[model samples]
Target chain A: MHNDIASLINSSVPGANASVVNPPEDGAGDSSVLVDSSKIYEVCEFLKTNDKFPFPVLQVISGVDYVEYFEVCYMLASFNLENSYQLILKTQLKDRENPELQSVVPVWAAANYQERECYDMIGVRFKDHPDHRRILCPDDWEGFPLRKDYEVQKVYRGMEVNPEAKMNFEDREFEVRKKEMEADLLKRQLERGH
Target chain B: MQTWDMGIKELQDETQDESMNTELLTVNMGPQHPATHGVLRVEIKTDSEIVAQAIPHIGYLHRCMEKHCESIDYRGIIPFVDRMDYLAAMNQELVYSMAVEKMLGTEVPRRAQVIRMIVSELQRIASHLMAFGTYALDLGAFSPFLYAFDEREKILRFFEEISGARLLYNYFWIGGVWNDMTNAHVSYIKDFLDNFEGELEKYDTLVSSNKIFLERVNNVGVLSVEDCFNYGATGPVLRGSGYKWDLRKVEPYLLYDEVKFDVPVGTGERGSTIGDCYNRYIVRMKEMEESVKIIRQCLDMLEPGPVIGKVSKVIKLPKGEIFYRQECPRGELGIHIVSTGEKTPYRVKVKSPCFTHVSMLPFMAPGQMVADFVATIGSIDIVLGEVDR
Candidate 1:
């Protein structure tokens, strides 16, 4: 199914270099097709309008940071076809500092807020989005919070950035020891046949 | 009524005058208004009473759930996922657990699958009950709000007994459920189902068929089929637009395929077109009954077995990216996880239904009366926690 989608994308869309990737060995059941970042808009337009595979719904747009590069994934589903199939389209950005890709909002209206969220979190800019402001973060927030190197701000507008305290290592260790002691006591009591 | 009629004529005469210029009024609906549902603020441009354009401002409740997912372990993300859609926490947990389970190649036991389906459907009923109650409250029907919440309280009590939490339940785990269900819990749910059917009919008579509600909602905020697809509406919003696209029937995740239930779409039974606010309200009312049918079947299929699958305490997923979606009460809740074969995830993205539903306001709000805009928001059912997650 993925190979058919890749070849169809390559032949139908201009300037698109599409190739299918293998499905995960764990049987997750959907392989992805990598498309050239420059031609993603045209490729998405073709996939959405093409009679063979009219993927009417753009289910999600996810952004992933891989340190050296960034990848934007498009999860599309077709309700028009008899047997519905999900097409995963991935586009890679080699430039870490300025990662940009063509927006698919023209093809799918659902991509509007999802792309803005991707930009706000992972710093992947989508060109030609209608309203490209941050969807989830404040407009003044610095750095993409989801980036691997980004750090949480210490303060915002005079208020301390105090996350609810997580258990420290010593606390965790003490809790583990307490559980083990209780288990040992229970085992000993069972062995006594009382 | 006579004074309102005279005022309309007087205002019309004033607007008709060449020298009298009418200016568009900009009104800020919320970040705190009860009718806005949550912390949603819309800057509405109104020409007299009809809205010209509405621009929604979100992110007021932003919590950066994606960033937290990168730091937390694969199994530890369930509680955070539950917070996204606090009303339907079980459904939210089910989607995240399924995504991680798929990446790890873990096959959940048959009994656990049935339990997950039953719990998720019950959560849907509870969530929809809240939607119904709050929607009525927004429309100024006090009695239905009390009645709806009274019925919803029973479902919450059932959730409290089964999962030990009424609102935010971290009951579902990666491989399976956190705990097994008891016979008493099953009987409690069965009892609720039997009594709730009659209550639903009473609710229908109380609110669904109310003449005032029909007049207020019918033909108001009508969304065309084209607009629905173009704006990526799903669940009841898309179904209300007369499209039969349901993730349960179309995608059929988990044991949804085995369960026999009808997908209720709007047929314009009221005096308006199919995709009006009234149709959307009816679609939710009908869906509650279908959920009851699913829960009954799941209870019948429940068996005694190990709930949790055999997985190591320290969980790790293989390097890949997977996007899993489920038919949540609001719409389609999608979780996209990018793994790097590490304990912590590389990236996590949530496709919240409320976010997309809220985005469609600019398209639907124009030409609608200011009061009808509240009905539009109620029909779409936006939750700020999921929207700003």
Candidate 2:
């Protein structure tokens, strides 16, 4: 199956290969393979066309964010061969800034909602997706809530939804800023009057 | 935009219109409607009676069961798992147990395996009964629901005697079942199986054989085998499309490999590829009988032994990851467990049957009649709690 997948991916796209993962101890000998993001479509095409590793069903599409790079995983199940495999596609992204990837919904229609969910939570931009709006949250929702650095004490749409302890600190900051702004305004008004 | 009028008398004539095209009307079906079974809303666009498009709106019943499971202990989360897909509670519990067992490498006793097989098959029957009853009502036949409910009550009686509850019975534990059945429970099941055939005939006479029900379900939502595979459909939905793929036979969990029972598959299309609502209905109806056969065999082979394996008071699964899938009534229900060698699971991801089933609706529901849409959804047998979870 690994060789078949390798040949399939190699034949379909240039510079695409499958690397096997060491099987976990005391577990099913299920192997994982890594793929380049640039050749994802070629791999997808190969799986759909080839008989041995026909990725007929897309089980799940989730994003695993490493600090340096983002791993977009696609779990494909082959009914023809009665086996399943995972395709981990990695792409480096700027840290603290959202990165974009092409949508695989065209390859498998089932990936539409899953990708949207990935985008909503992980803040990955799925390029050219139809209706790439936040699915689990409102449209105007800020911050990728699932990100490790995402602050829990965040304000959105004029509502202070964070904890009361944080609210005290935020309130003190707000009062200090308000006083400074008011003093600045008074100074400006006095100058204008002069 | 322009207003047109010839005279006061001529304005009375409403037939003269320029917008000749008839547009598809959008109808929001339910966040509250009865047929939805729960808070599932499908935004449907229709041209008169035929559905132009359908976009299923889920998340209404989303309890975040996956995230919730991570916070609770492994043993503490079993009851909450039962509520996800409330119909096939035993199967839900079993899949979780299978995942935990796979992680721990626990071997359940042969006696317990047989008992698990028996209860799982019985739960399949009960799950199919709910599906069939609700499917009948969706197609405008109320009598079948009543008759099906009546038959289901007998199964519930058996369930109550075994586990103290009717629905949502958290019977299956990690290593084995919570309790072993008595002779009375075994005999009651035998009697129910004996009478199930006669009761199924009542359903055939009341609903399956009825012309109206047949017309509504026969070729309404034709999901091909290719579509079934593509959408990750399993259980009766896949089997109904002529795929002889049963996890019990393929994966052979518990004592299923030892059991001698036929895999009931649909003869799709022209006795081969129909894959329509009727095929799904017929497959489930036949599967109930098949389940009964397995149950009868289990009863004859029943042996007395300890029901549970060596399970710790605190189920601290070894630090590992295991994805266990089982053939549930609707489709494949899976539990992906990531254990950190702790009392609580590190992460729990449930691959719900209805999640895959409902994903196929946007494609299947279009080009179907508005009325047939409900029938098609019912045929899919979606429990929205599972979908939204």
Candidate 3:
């Protein structure tokens, strides 16, 4: 059903280059429609308004970094009205330096802050996003913290970011944790008949 | 000085006139104020007694839950997820376990599922009690807060008996529970429910119909059904808008399909309209009864079996992404994990209801009284820990 909706979206909506991305071999997740980053706003608008698949509620917009590019996911569901459906929309931006995507705030009001969060965590700026500022971090805070290559700065206004950075295995708490972990592993192995 | 019958633009055009003296007053309501709840600070722009805007500024309690999940192992992320919404940690753990169990394809034992249902319902009652306690105090009704705490303490005691910790219990494992629940625990839960039902009736008479509480919440901060959908509201907030959509009833995760429970939604009864603060509180109040019903059913369904499922030593998620959502006390707590066939997740994104619901403040706050803003904030039942996670 989700694939049929994706194909309908790909064919009906003009400039929509959406392709269904099937779940991997593990089958952990549902199949998602990967749309072009530039045409995401239209695809999302169509998804909400179209009669065939009207997924009105925009739930979460998450950003993931793949070292070379960023994948921005839009999770939506039709919990408000009839035709209950949970759909995922993905758009990948290969631009490492200035990753950008169209904002879906026009489609759903829930997109307002979630889009800000996406911009805050992974540095994926949403085009035409009103009040597009850092949400979880201060405006002056440097670096996208969620990115795999993100580096923590040595100092923020001379305050120590990591106060216990020099902690070694010789520390009392560390030694206690190591002992407790070993005990837990042994117990788990016994339970598994290892 | 208050005799301007013209609109805002006309008043601005006549700003040179001395009679129109009032300007928009912007007040910061807190990263510390009591009414704002936790570290949520709302910048309220008011014109006289009415609010023009209420911009919520969060992130004071941001703990980088996603960043930590990226580095931690699968089982290790459970306790970390518990802190996201500390009030209802069981539900959080349950949802996270469901996600991980999906990755590993682990089917939980029957007894474990029943125990999970019972404990999560108990946690819901406790969480809603805290919500009401704080919400009533926000509206200056202290007696109800005290009553709520007394009952909440009992639920906490039950939680302590099941798991060691009172607040954040790391009991629900990926495959199943940490330990099996004894039969004695079941009878104790039944007795607690018998007493709790009477206490709930006492509360309905004590505060639910109180004139002042109704005056503070009724018709104030009213959200239309369209506003709810557009704002992506869920849980009681969506239910308060007269929507009967519940994940338990509709989606039915973790043996909810077999259970018989009526999802109570806002009806806009004689005194209060739908989607108002009054209706929201009433929805939660009535939900406790429904929760009690679910727990009674779980007790009958409970059977003797192993608590934990068969899980391997080294757990790794395959290269894929999955989203698991469940009905939490606050709203839908979903965990969307993207993996790379590694020991740790590539990204763990949480869709907390507070984050979306709090955004509705700016939409609902305009044109309401400044005092009602407190009622509005409290009515949303936001936990900043989840909002800023």
Candidate 4:
């Protein structure tokens, strides 16, 4: 499956530096191929539309920040093929600050929200993406929260950014309430005994 | 008398002409509305009553689950996974645990696999019941909602007995389940399954065959096979388009290959072509019966053995990435994890099914009636918790 996908990507997409990589010993069932970030869209389009490697469903697009660089992984599965085959296509981005890649939404409409999520979390910009915006965060929110160096803001709007506000209850108050309840129970038991 | 009749006819003609010149109206459906199922806001453009277009705006329930995964260890993420799709928390826990297990190259015990199958199937039934009841409520039927919830509450009782939680069960661990199921709980599930068919029959008579229900759902919000693929719609929504693309049959995970069950597809039995709202409803109804079949087989094959596998307490994954796909109740729940030989995951991306379903709303909602819009949203069976996460 890996070789077939590699050959298909090589033959169909010009200037796409694609190569099939040997599966890691602990890697799950499917094999993966490393493709250039610029030609990811072309390779994906060919794989999705080609007869031999018809990976119709784009399952997921996950972005990972690896300190030195960034990697975007695409999990693709086929429904039209004989036995369903899963394929992984990884593209590396060297520029971590303004990472950019071609969008595959024109090939698979499912990429619309997933790409936006990648951008929102990892700060990867997909060129030519329609309706590109922060999906899970507010429009006015600051830095990408998923990045390793992202620091929580002290305040947003006029409210303080305290994590304690999100807690269900404070420890001291809960302890005090428990003591009060125990005392009341002891008084009731003594009265009943009398 | 003739002059009076002419005057009334002329007034009627003028009113008809005015009604014909309709203006487009934009309406907001959610972010707080009960019919949307959760905090989903759909900006719908309509010409009087027919929707010209509908754009869904999500993120009201965004909890930044992926970001949290980066800080928490593999074992600590199960509770967070349960919160993603609160309706099918078992299945959510199963997929996350399975992914982490795959990354660690650990083998799950046979007993644990069987138990996972049983619990996951039960969760499927419970999730479908929620979808069924809520879909009925969306269509203005009040009785079926009560009837469906009555059955669902019984399933929750069974889950509570086994996992000690009614809704969000963080029971499924990375190597195996949190605890073993007793004979008493097994028998309770068996008894529930035995009586479930009768309840389903009652629902069919009350809602499925009712004329008003049929009129509201039939031939409304149709999705073509091409459209389903383009939009990446899965589970019942894709099955409703007459595609036999079930992950259980196609890419059998866990012990799904051992189970005998049918994949129900849309046959256009409700006087409409395949992929309509009615077909999606019927597919879910049929799927519940198949889930019962699977659960019965699992119960027969279940044996007494160790539930949790032998693994290190502190899980340190090798440097690699893997994408695990499970046939979740709503659709294909894919978990993509990237590890850097660390205790915590480098990146964890959950490809939630409802998120894709919500994305397809813009494509499905145009040219549909404003009232049918509710039926369309319900037919897709999206939980906003999953979508926003």
TM-score of each: 0.91, 0.83, 0.93, 0.90
Expressed as tens digits, the lDDT of each residue in B47-125 for candidate 4 is 6566778888889999999888887788889999999999999999999898888877789999999999999999999
Query: By TM-score, highest first, what's the ranking?
Result: 3, 1, 4, 2
| Per-residue alpha-carbon lDDT of candidate 1 for residues B238-303, written as tens digits (9 for 90 to 100) | 899898878888878788899899999999996968999999989999999999999999999999
B258: Cα error in model 3, Å: 1.4
What lDDT score goes with residue B383 in model 3? 92
Clashes of each: 0, 5, 0, 0
TM-score of 4: 0.90
The stretch of ten residues in a row with the least summed lDDT in candidate 4 chain B is: B1-10
DockQ of 1: 0.41
Residue runs of model 2 more than 4 Å from their true location after superposition: A1-14, A23-30, A62-72, A81-96, A136-194, B1-18, B268-273
- Top of the candidates by TM-score: 3
For B9-119, candidate 2 gives per-residue lDDT tens digits of: 233233246564456689999989767767888999876566768888877786656656766788878898899899888989989887788777789988888898899
How high is each candidate's interface RMSD, in Å?
2.5, 3.5, 1.6, 2.5
* TM-score pick, better of 1 and 4: 1
User: Model 2: clashing residue pairs?
Assistant: B268-B272, B268-B273, B268-B274, B269-B273, B269-B274
**Cα lDDT tens digits for candidate 3, B147-186:** 9999999889888988999999999998899987887888
Query: What are the lDDT figures for the candidates, one per model?
Result: 0.86, 0.75, 0.88, 0.86
Residue clash pairs of candidate 3:
none
lDDT of 3 by residue, A10-42 (tens): 788877777889877655666788888888888
Best by lDDT: 3
